[model samples]
Target: SRSLLKLLEAKALIELSNQTKPPQGWPSSPARNLEIPPNLNPDQANVLQLFQNQREQKEWLLWGVTGSGKTEIYLRCCIPELEAGRSVLMLTPEIGLIPQLLERCQRRFGNAVVPYHSALSEGERLATWRYCRSGSPCVVVGTRSAIFLPLPKLGLIVLDEEHDSSYKQEAPMPCYHTRDVARLRQQQEGCGILLGSATPCLETWLACQKPNNSIGLLHLPQRIAARPLPPVRVVDMRQELADGNRQLLSRPLLERLSGLAKRKQQAVVLVPRRGYSTFLSCRSCGQAVTCPHCDVSLTVHRNSDGHSWLRCHWCDHRDEIATNCGQCGSTAFKPFGAGTQKVLEQLELELEGIRLLRFDRDSTRGRDGHKQLLERFAAGEADVLVGTQMLAKGMDLPKVTLAAVLAADGLLHRPDLRAAEQSLQLLLQLAGRAGRGEQPGEVLVQTYDPDHRVIQHLIAGSYAEFLEEEAAVRRIARLAPYSRACLLRFAGPQASLTASAAATLLNHVANQLREADWLAIGPAPAPRARVAGLSRWQLLLQGPPASPIPLPSEQILRRLLPKGVHLAIDPDPMEL
Candidate 1:
């Protein structure tokens, strides 16, 4: 080995080396794929066998719809790895659900079960990360970034909710989809990979299409009761508002909520944002007072300074509430949008003596915040929970028989093209939260655009129809799940400088990028456009090649940059 190394080193192609092999009898095993539980579905058995028998590729998209018993199927795939004494990392959308997943992992693996999440202290996270690497047939339950967890014998990787946008990492190091990263790692290490979701991202589905099919597609569509999907009722908000329904709860929804309460069934009111008011807008000028630091609108929050602050959402820039509107210097300013706090106040007045719980970044800021709130809600201590998009992921509650999307319209209003897909996913996921137990569940979706295709499809429970319509738009617009996207953002104090830098950077990118092969948009200023006093500008790139090209983002940083500009390359960005 030393001689071989010396020969290779002489060729001047060496950086560093830490070659090692698995422990004795570590990975040798005859195919046990057919050993699936006798009662397991044939499709489930096929999925397991694909992992056990197919070694040519490392990734598998287990496209199981809600209540498809995908979790059980995932368990089947994990059996072989566990038997071989290898570790598994299961990634979920949020840590709020981590405890629930941990319960399942523990129930199956007992003391062998291990968990990791951002909510854990740094030391605890580090310890668990180290422990997984130290060798154990452990299962690590965590959020998207948990893909980086180092395990000595990684035999299987499972990404629950593969289509969920939370898989797109926004901060910290090695910012990449836990799903994609897991696939890469599995390939590198020759382990099996699984991507599970109720609404599989088109990218994953398309990737698995036969070569003649790019990859393979698998499905588990029916509920485990195999009971039917819950009934979804769409309430048009336009007419409801014209009748003077202030907080926008439709009459039918109010009646349903009353019935649920009387039946002792709890419900959820979903408000997609936190805080009282996102911004103070001028009634006269239609302009909002924004934060100078971030390239976005300022949030009006009551702070300890004895006054309200216009706080940047991305950074810590703050300005006291304005006496005059910046646009027209109009004194007639008003809170234009509703957040969780506003929704909470309205729901309290609208409903009877219901015990309400609120969940959001602000509410879950501390270490144990997520755990405590989730526990209380799960224990049925809260009759109603009001929250931001934080509550829109995979959370199971048997008693939550009714879910009122106080406003589903917010999902449609986004700079992202996956807005419709995201909107549908959130609607379905939130709706799934209801009727888990014996009592059936119902969803009340209040949307002004009731006729929108996505809303219509969700209301009718026609996922296939929705996919076809959505795929049409994506193919036309070159949006995702069909192609890959890279976002480059430049941020700094001066808007002009940031814009100039961003434009110049975009020019360089346009020159370097293969024009005929890729799509490029902007060097335009970002939507939020500023944060914590830094002006932000962005460039969005879309590619459809068989292989992804590493974006030239860092190279731009290496080049001469405008003084205060910053750069972020978000592949498959969730937000603009």
Candidate 2:
């Protein structure tokens, strides 16, 4: 009876025992005057036809190049579903992308477009949940969390930028990926699912290649109206240094930014980090300032009122920067590495009277922070928008003629297997932001290693070629897309205790799975040894290609580990 009441409250089941009259009918459907866009290109039109013909297909991948009118294809596919009185759920990887996408969906579908994301207030989310439960046909545009929304008569699910790591929930319990959940929903609701991306993850690409796989493949090879992808020019930082130029902005990139005002165009500058500097180091001892709580260096953050402090990006720990080094008691200190704030400061100093806007997490805060900054940039309030990786995701700005990446080496030199692939994806996605309009766009990538594989692929604009090569390497090494992995993380106040607990749990699982295809990899310290004062250790369970690893139940795991130690099991973890 309690469960029945709960279902009634969620509008999933209506009670008729106490009703004297018939229940009221559902609310009136919104007016459907969908503003259909111009005709789709041949590639997109072909995908639409394929989608229509394969009604029994449960999943499809739309592998389209950037600026190839993928969004138009999405709109076209949804039109028929909406007309059939079914609902469409559109998912984006980031909340920052919601505003632009929401505006477009609303413009096209009118009041039938429902915007849902974590950024919305609790009350707003509750109202949306209720509305979707009303069983009315509508389109819901949101981020990864939107996968959980209940849609009656769900006809389709669309995941844009499916390659992004944001779709994976790394923290908290019950870790999962949005795409996996979407597939689960498809199985339950019998609806079609579409994954659209410019640079698809190796896993999805491989899945589509299987001979009898249910996932179909759709390709859009060219940009709409025959506009070319932006040409990328890699600037060797080593060469720039040899030429007596040590500025963060390369000579050519600076020259381009300098003429933005005269050329009457905008530019987007992407910096990997967000603070004024990556870390503060002692000149004498060469020791960087480290966070007390986290096992990482403290970043230098400067406020508008001429105040600076040290912050740990991992734990949000803040501390005052000491004048002297802790290790050597040296008075001389230097800030190392360029961040978004430093880039903005450099631009203000290099170009006179040039407007600049910082678009990173620090700059965008509160409920409407992202939308406000984006609107300002779109209105031409600033000539240059300096930001972090958020600038690389699915933003369509027609007037942006130049896109520049600062300190690209930071992105390339990550300690992850997918680093190169992700780097190329980010660079290409950022390049796509430019050249969407009338003028051809130019991309400048400043890196110490200009001939790096990722950089080379970026210059050639050969995403498929890069994927092919990368697949070979991954296949050889038995990495992801060829193997299955689950990460078991243990954290506690004491490092020794946490490590011992992790080791015990690993031994327990290994003994149980000794005869199975799964292989146990570690009981070692995590990549980040500690965070927010908790010592962390991890164990990885890997399986054969295309095989699922069966992990121990959470209850059994908790019982095995020490009482004070916390355990988190992540299936198909995106990050190590």
Best by lDDT: 2
Segments in model 2 whose C-alpha atoms lie over 4 Å from true places: 1-34
TM-score of each: 0.85, 0.94
List model 1 lDDT by residue over 188-245, tens digit each: 8877777887777766666665475435566776766665678988888888888897
Clash number by candidate, in order: 24, 0
* Best model number under TM-score: 2
- The digit string of per-residue lDDT tens for model 2 on 232-284 reads 99889999999999899899998999989888899999999999999999999
Model 1 is weakest, by summed lDDT over 10 consecutive residues, at 22-31
The count of backbone overlaps in candidate 2 is: 0
